[model samples]
Target: MRVLIVEDHEELAHTVAAGLRREGMAVDVALDGHTGLERASVNDYDVVVLDRDLPGLHGDEVCGRLAAGDRPARVLMLTAAGTIDDRVSGLGIGADDYLPKPFAFAELVARIRALARRTRPALPPVLVHGGLRLDPSTRVATRDGHRLMLSPKEFAVLELLLSARGAVVSAEQLLERGWDEFADPFTQTVKVTVSRLRRKLGDPPLIETVPQAGYRI
Candidate 1:
């Protein structure tokens, strides 16, 4: 999943972003609330990790603005203030879930996943197109009942394609969702990952290239 992290704490934000990246999720960080709001306005993210106490805009205002905006993504409010009133107020402003600070990384990951699942259109956890089956939670891909091992990047690319199913996914879209903003489009990284995934899948070319467009499953 693609996520935006809005936190002023540099070290904590970096640690959370790194951990999420290791879990096969694309992440972007904003050090202050103003930048975070700006980033959220333009980017299409599946989830946003927002801090309640912010510099320019308080986390509640941020959530309210996002709710009122053209595109509203799932918000998981994070705060050092762990109180019943705080949680209620955060949710009242439009947060999907409220997570307190000093949380376990595992719990954070689980909550993010839950928030994504809740916001996404109802669909089976096991996504399938043709002979391929992908479990997003487990990061596992299987073809004809046989499990296929994939590197982290490979798994991410495959997940993007499979989630879109028959719809074409542009290289830009893949880059936005499967990789961080720093990824270079001209590096052929997506292509290399796709090639590796194809080799492991061993099928009648489940992925189809959309000439001048991108790739589709």
Candidate 2:
């Protein structure tokens, strides 16, 4: 999944971004709310982790604008305050969920994944096709009962392709969702990842490439 973190705490923002990236998510960090909004405007994200207190623009206003805008990214508001009133106000503004400071990293990851599920049509928690099985929660993949060791990018590409349910997914879509903003559009990242994934899947190739189209499972 793609996530935008709008936190003024530079260290915190980068730290969280790195963690999320390790979880196989495409993450972008914005040091302030205005940059957050600008990043959100151009990129499609599954979730936005917004800090309540921000510079340039307040997180509350950012959430409000996002709620009113055309994009459909779920917002998870964060603050140092942990009170009934604080949470109610944050949700009242537009946050889909609220997290207080000093929260467990596991809970944050869980909440982000839960919010991401609401973004598009629901799919099975564990995706299965043929003899292939993938569990997002466990970050495990197996083919014909044999385990497949995949890199973060390869796993993400496979997950996205499997989630398509036989529909053609363009390279651009893969790049947008499987990679962060730093990825060059002209790069062969998607192709390379897919090629690696196919090799790992072994014989009886599952991914099909369409000339001038994209790829499908």
Candidate 3:
């Protein structure tokens, strides 16, 4: 999943971004609310980690604007104020969930996962197709009990295809979900990565190319 983190706290933001990246999620960071809103508006993010108090615009405004905008990404409001009123106000303003400061990383991850589950119609974390099994959490792909090594981007593409299970996924959909906003969709990067992934997967041809469409597992 791709996530946009809008937080002014440098250390905390880096920590959260790093943790999410380790979990095999693509993450982008914005230090202020305006940039956060802009990034959230342009990108296809699974979730947005927005701070309630921001420099350019308040988190509530950001959430409201996102909900009113063309592309609405799920918002997870974060603030130092831990009160029932604060949580209610954040949610009332269109935030999907609220997480107070100094919170446990596990809980934060869980909340993000929950929001992601609700926003994106994906298969369970573990996706299976015949003898192929993919563990998203561990970023591991196994075929017939043998572990497969894959690059981050390659793994992401395979995960997207496997999640769809046999249905064809369009290139636009793969670019939106498998890669970040800056990725060049028109380029051959996706094809190259898929080629490499196929080589790694070896026989049986797990990934089925859909010509102009995309790929299916």
The Cα RMSD in angstroms, rounded to one decimal, for candidate 3 relative to the true structure is 2.3
Taking the tens digit of each residue's C-alpha lDDT, what string does model 2 give over 58-177? 999999999999997999999999999999999999899999997888899999988877846877778899999988777899999999999999888998889899999999999998
C-alpha RMSD for every candidate? 1.7, 1.2, 2.3
Ranking 2 against 3 by TM-score, winner:
2
Clashing pairs in 3: none
Return the top candidate by TM-score: 2
Clashes of each: 0, 0, 0
Local accuracy of candidate 3 as per-residue lDDT tens digits, 10-56: 88898999998777778899998999988887788888999999877
Report the poorest 10 consecutive residues by lDDT, candidate 2. Answer: 116-125
The CA lDDT at 10 in model 3 is 85
- For model 1, the stretches where C-alpha displacement exceeds 4 angstroms are none
> What ranges in model 3 sit over 4 Å off?
70-72, 120-122
Question: CA lDDT, every prediction?
Answer: 0.85, 0.92, 0.84
- Candidate 3, backbone clash total: 0
Q: TM-score of the candidate numbered 3?
A: 0.86
User: Candidate 1: which pairs clash?
Assistant: none
lDDT of 1: 0.85
